[model samples]
Target: MAESLDTALVPAHVAVIMDGNGRWAQRRGLSRSEGHRAGTRTAKAIVTRARELGVRHLTLYTFSRENWSRPKDEVALIFDLLVEYMKGELANLLDQDIRLLVLGDFDGLPFVARQSLAHVMAKTAHCRAMTLNLALNYSGREEILRASRALAQKCAAGTLEPESLDEAAFAAELYTAGQPDPDLIIRTSGELRLSNYLLFQAAYAEFYFTDTLWPDFDAAELERALADYQRRQRRFGKTGEQVAE
Candidate 1:
């Protein structure tokens, strides 16, 4: 795998929308649960790879709020897998100095899942090498709405002024308040839409779509994404030529 992508343009954070696990399983005649389990293993490998590639933050869209619409059995399987993955990866996370954090609404999750998430987060809070943010039971639209409601409550209580709202103030209300916006967003299985993941944070993020399913993603794919990110000239609001000059 390629390494040392140009520091200037390489993404500081890479967020993934892991998709197509069900399709992958159906293709092979396996159960969706097995696909999810395989995807979890891929997640573990790529988190380590992201750290190796000098990515400071890696955010994974593990389970979206919308996922609850799926069959109840599938949803239960996902929650079970999350608990098991956290317990299994605890040692690896601590030994590798990777901080594990969860972003999203936990209010509706099963009690045991919530406890497991909290326990994992507490255990890895001190690791500084890299942060692996798992977006479990998360949705960007829901998050923004939650923040908006909080802001309104503050305004109603006279603690915040309605006229003082700005990007900075609004961002602080997000689930990822202290984290930098994702610089690159990866979606597997050739998906073309954001699927309501990180809508606010990925406003300017460069995207890399792959036909490979989430369960198949590995270190080489990550390196390719980083190398591709380095080759692009991100002008933000300006033309490429104007920004370069």
Candidate 2:
């Protein structure tokens, strides 16, 4: 699949909304947990593939703030799988030079999950080739509000001027902080909405939606998305002719 793609056109950063796991499992007469397990396998493959394709940043919507609304057992199972994934993939992550970063409230997670993530993250802290961000307990609105409140606090303390706040300053407070904004955002299961994922960072991102469920979204599908991205002309608010020039 990499051989067929234009290397220069590959996105520097890719964000994914892995959706339809429950539906995928339902179609197979399997439990939702089973579908999540299958999706985890797919995530492993996609991470390796993305690294091979030279993607510097890869963010997966692993768990959201709203995901806590799921059934208790299912939520517990998801975190268990998260722990398993972290422990199981630590070696591979180090071998591949991919650093693990979490883009949410770390203290809010279950103790086991927090411990596993902390251990793996520390072990891979020096990795420089790529960064893999797991968006656990993340909410775009909450992040924005958090940033806003931080800036407001600085203002109240007279440490930062209200007039000095700019896009860069605001962005620096985001979870993505120093990382480049995503060039491509892909959502599976044919979902057309952002679902509150990366609302601010995706302002100029090229979106690719597909009917394939998360468990079935493989390397081939990823290649297709990249191919589609390469064919488009990103004007970034400029006219096509201006960009072409």
- The prediction achieving the highest TM-score against the true structure is 2
The per-model lDDT (C-alpha) reads 0.87, 0.94
Which parts of model 2 are misplaced by more than 4 Å?
A: 241-245
How do the residues 162-192 of candidate 2 rate in per-residue lDDT, one tens digit apiece? 9999999999999999999999999999889
List of clashing residue pairs for candidate 1: none
Q: Write the per-residue lDDT of candidate 1 for residues 46-76, one digit (tens) a residue.
A: 9988887678889999988888899999999
* TM-score to native of every candidate shown: 0.94, 0.97
* Candidate 1, run of 10 with poorest lDDT: 236-245
Q: How accurate is candidate 2 locally (lDDT)?
A: 0.94
Cα TM-score of candidate 1: 0.94
Per-model RMSD to reference: 2.0, 1.5
User: Which clashing pairs does model 2 show?
Assistant: none
Please list the residue runs of candidate 1 whose C-alpha ends up more than 4 Å from where it truly belongs after superposition.
240-245
User: Going through the candidates in order, what is the number of backbone clashes in each?
Assistant: 0, 0
